[model samples]
Target chain A: GESVGLHLPTLSVQEGDNSIINCAYSNSASDYFIWYKQESGKGPQFIIDIRSNMDKRQGQRVTVLLNKTVKHLSLQIAATQPGDSAVYFCAEGRDSNYQLIWGAGTKLIIKP
Target chain B: EADIYQTPRYLVIGTGKKITLECSQTMGHDKMYWYQQDPGMELHLIHYSYGVNSTEKGDLSSESTVSRIRTEHFPLTLESARPSHTSQYLCASSDFMGSRETQYFGPGTRLLVL
Candidate 1:
């Protein structure tokens, strides 16, 4: 499925429950990927990243799963907290340009 | 915990005005990038530089230009601001040359052109 080709506005999710954000990249040669969390009034903070060689990678509280066959990427957060409410972005490495291609962010919300 | 910094966190300028957003890093990174983002949206790469005196335009067609005079400094300039140019500009740096390198970002400069 073509996932990351379009640019959208926002995303909303609840707190406490697990949160899953999805991204679909356009390029197939993109070998590396990263997830970033941006809080209000702050710059993006690195979450986790995965290379083409791996299908899944886990961090302190986040996990990144990559499906190269479909060019799909996902970020999963356990026990989402209010402080976790922010915009999450997915980025990829451009094989030809040596730059990262970014996806439209998914805004995670923590509904009290 | 990134040492990158962007000045004039917020700016409101009139159309046709010339503006420059400054970005600097103390991490001594070799790769730097400039991205234009609307509030909470995808980041469009505007420009990038691999090292001093090296720069290249990005995927998005941008009216802004950037310069890399020093390894740690990559500033973007809009010759003439317009309403369409109103957006948040973010600066990032990376250690380039590593197979797995992370890009650290600055707080960003929010520009509102009226």
Candidate 2:
């Protein structure tokens, strides 16, 4: 479930710099992984989650890195702010009864 | 103020009519969700409920339909509207009990089935 091509790809950080967003997932049993923050009209707010035996996880300023061999997943934003711009999603799951499975969103622009 | 509410934030119905999209939560969550995005796409789960009247059906095949009597309400109905059913319709709630439960979203409900 990964094929979205219109490329809204853009990430220009600067406010205080430190923003990285990258994702590549295709389920390898997808234990659990989440990071979402969509702002334009809102409705996507959980911003940090990691499972799959844990590869990395942090919160508050955000940070979630998990690489199950290469299924890759990353989201690090510490300090950047303009309210943190918008669109940022990367989710996968196979836990808590399953529900998440999203990624094709990465638009965090805040270069002031 | 734990909240999650969605309503007619914006609508423009005209095709076949009959639309209902309202979701509420005062945080007494018992798991509830419904998602469908279309602008930048990716986020498709059509329905879910793990409490009250319990309902389930998600994975994009949705003509719309959901209900959960009272656990803070979970409504989504389309019965008719079309035009591919416009877009944006999100409502989430979580805390399916114990162990790290996260998912609290609302502030979405933008339909335009014209």
Q: Model 1 compared with the native: what TM-score?
A: 0.92
Interface RMSD of each: 1.6, 8.0
Give me candidate 2's TM-score against the actual structure.
Answer: 0.33
lDDT value for candidate 2? 0.82
TM-score per candidate, chains pooled? 0.92, 0.33
In model 2, state the lDDT of residue A95: 65
Candidate 1, residues A38-111, lDDT tens digits: the string is 99888888888888889999998889999888878888899888989889999887545557777788888888
Q: Which stretches of candidate 1 lie over 4 Å from their true place?
A: A1-12, A94-97
Q: TM-score for the first chain of model 2?
A: 0.33
The lowest-lDDT stretch of 10 consecutive residues in candidate 1 chain A is A1-10
Candidate 2 segments whose C-alpha is farther than 4 A from its true place:
A1-16, A19-30, A42-50, A57-75, A78-84, A87-96, A100-111, B1-9, B12-18, B21-46, B49-54, B57-75, B78-88, B91-114
Task: Give the distance in Å from residue B81's predicted Cα in candidate 2 to where it truly belongs.
Answer: 17
User: Candidate 2 lDDT, tens digit per residue, B58-97?
Assistant: 8788788998999999999988998988989988898742
Against the hidden true structure, what lDDT does model 1 obtain? Answer: 0.85
